[model samples]
Target chain A: MSYNKRNDGRAFDELRPMDAKVGIIKNALGSAMFRIGKTVALAAVYGPSELFPKFLQKKEEGLLRCTYNMMAFSGSGTRVKPGPSRRSREIELVTRNALESVLDLSECPRAVINVNIELIQTDAGTRCAGICAASMALADAGFKMKDLVAAVSAGLVGDKIVLDLDYSEESFEEGAVDIPMAFMPRTGKIALLQLDGEITKEQLREAIKLAKKGCKQICEVQRQALKEKYKTEE
Target chain B: MGILIEDKQIVVPGEEVAEGMDFLPAPGTFRDGDKIVACQLGLVNISGRLIKVIPLEGAYMPKRGDVVIGKINDLTYSNWFVDIGYAYEAALSMKEATTEFIERGAELTDYYTYDDVIVAKITNVTKSKSIDLSMIGPGLRKLQGGRLLEISAQKVPRVVGKQGSMISMIKEITNCQIIVGQNGRVWISGTEIWQERLASEAVLLIARKAHTHGLTDRVKAFLESGSKK
Candidate 1:
């Protein structure tokens, strides 16, 4: 394998520049915006309020609902669309499940906590960024959480594991095995793990190690964002 | 196995509180195998044989007999649906609405109309999560000419203070009629607009700084400053 420089100039083990902030949108119980290089997503949490369609209400636990939308202009190609496409719907489920694992939804048995994520701009890693930001917004909204669900996506590019794939590397025509993973950093437990393509078992083990390290670093940024949001003078 | 976390220490959801069968689990914690785990992020409260976590913040879970301020959302011939700022709308039946016999064919709006704020007691919460409310109690009435405000339901306790000291002080100083619901809705009414404004600001200040120390003094000082202006 040749060690050639990637287009974005990031090393195989380097992540794109990340930025995150909480409480960006008012009127939300909690809000956060997260950016991964060119990929940007905003997440807002509402409720612990009410859930709908009466019959779906769970007696044992409340619902942690999520809505994921990618704006029409977020993509590089043509304007996508305003509504939720199948891709965004799948991302919504992924985000909600990852978040529910860490939330104490049973605290409010008959209500729901709504998490909304809007992809403002996209290059890659929108879903992972959304999960990271949604968890921060949940903390900012002051929900007791087991830990932030810090997520990172890695891929096997040319027989090497890359930390976070940019748009170009993710959609490389030669094909790559994309792995998106989420972890509850406090417990160091896996919350989400998805593999898009095949990789050798040995390579998969190595990829997880890199992803876990990346998630740890991402969790630090999330904690810092919460600290900034609640930075009160001692 | 022994306790893995210190008493009064904060733990996030899913964090282990104890590692053995020697300890008894309490609210905010559940048994996971032989270990005791926290179900919510809260400060661990340990008492002799019981271990529980006290959550610092979250939405209110309404229960029976909770006195909540609700808004009239929908009205029918037999009942009124009121939104108590939660998942279930409290149902106010005509029988529980007023002591006076609401005769047949009497317009339901004669007693209360749409958007009217009413202070009611939660009578029953059914198996399907329907809330039943009644106004047949002292201090429960239709709010008249008062401005309503809301804060995080979890912060309501701080606003009320120790034995109503904080709220009573605000009420006495501002000469305002103040009612604080456990669900975090406050009603501030005064004879004058200036008095109402001062009272509202003071309450908002309390809600904002509820988690901090010496909040009573802070609210008193804040009100004093506002009176000067």
Candidate 2:
């Protein structure tokens, strides 16, 4: 049966409510928290400092290292393992790739900027939320960047296109096709795109267009969060 | 020629600061096509034809000729590695460590041992970020029996205030000798412990409210109030 309505009562092209905040982690150089639906991601940026082990040091540019993790009780289905898992490692790599394109780290060669993303709660679109949080944290750290990254998940749930799939939509009775994408809003460049499950070419194109609109909204929220940190007290 | 943002307005990375070629982009901002964009999270500063953004926060980037307070972290045969709150540890050679020269094999620890905090000047910073420090300048010496307070490096200017006015006032009121490093390490020493604490409190206040208006007066009022208590 074709899905007629969203599980959460949101429109087909509508996104889940988003909340973003920066400078939440006092000890870190930069930090942010991003929440979409039930997924909550906190990202902290540390260093342009010396990279240990010596071998990982880059002579031309600083290294952007990302670590993505989920708390033990963050998962909606089951308890997550505390340490790094294969899935988490893959997300970390993708998160780094998504943010590295905008950063200008040439000034601090041989240094490393570490971005640690933790999921305090999860529904679906965990990786996308992590990327969103990491991007804001990097900007908050005052790193040179061309633009901020905004990410969202758009998918084909049954026969209908949906924006920002929550847990229920992701686990639709009829198979769902989940596509997580990130974009540089100013340049209209794609930083990340991942697809899981099958969809027609026409449907994929439609989903991407919808995701771009969602990402634009997310970019605004991210920009507002960064500006909020430095707003003069009235 | 139009400027997209007002002067002193906070801007984020990739935000457009100006829309015309008439404005030249300065540090913390970059030219992107015809537009000048902020590459940092900072306040826009427009001076004449130059538009720059003053960063609100970041790790301290080392610059030459800056007086910094550093701790001796490691010692080799020829140099002492000083951690100056930067990405890399700086090298302080024996030649730069003291004015008087001695034998080549002399123990380096006699002048600056492990964990000794000293006020030094940055002599050189290589393109690869290797820093060289010198302690031969006047007022440069090992800090003894003083508490160290660390703040964001960006707030050093406010802590020092205009023409060293803010720091001098704090020192005079608290009766403490205060040295603020460009790296944001502050050394406060006084005849009495309470005086040192007061100086530290005042400096911390300046750092905290650096971006606020009329900060100098507020700091003075705070110091005067503290002295009376």
lDDT of 2 by residue, A1-234 (tens): 999988789999998999999999999999999999999999999998889999999988889999999998898575378898888889999989999988988878899999999999999999999999998998888788888899999999999999999989888988999999999888889999999999999999999999999999999999998887656442
TM-score of each: 0.88, 0.97
Q: Judged by DockQ, which candidate is best?
A: 2
Q: Which ten residues in a row have the lowest lDDT in candidate 1 chain B?
A: B54-63
Per-candidate chain B TM: 0.88, 0.96
RMSD of each: 3.2, 1.5
Report the C-alpha lDDT of model 1 over B182-213, residue by residue, as the tens digit: 77899999998999999998888877765456
Give the CAPRI class of candidate 2.
medium
Q: Scoring only the second chain, what is candidate 2's TM-score?
A: 0.96
Q: Please, what are the lDDT tens digits per residue for candidate 2 over residues B91-156?
A: 998889999886877877888899999999999988888999999989999999989999999889
Reference-based lDDT, each prediction: 0.82, 0.91
Weakest 10 consecutive residues, lDDT, candidate 2 chain A? Answer: A225-234
Complex DockQ per candidate? 0.34, 0.71
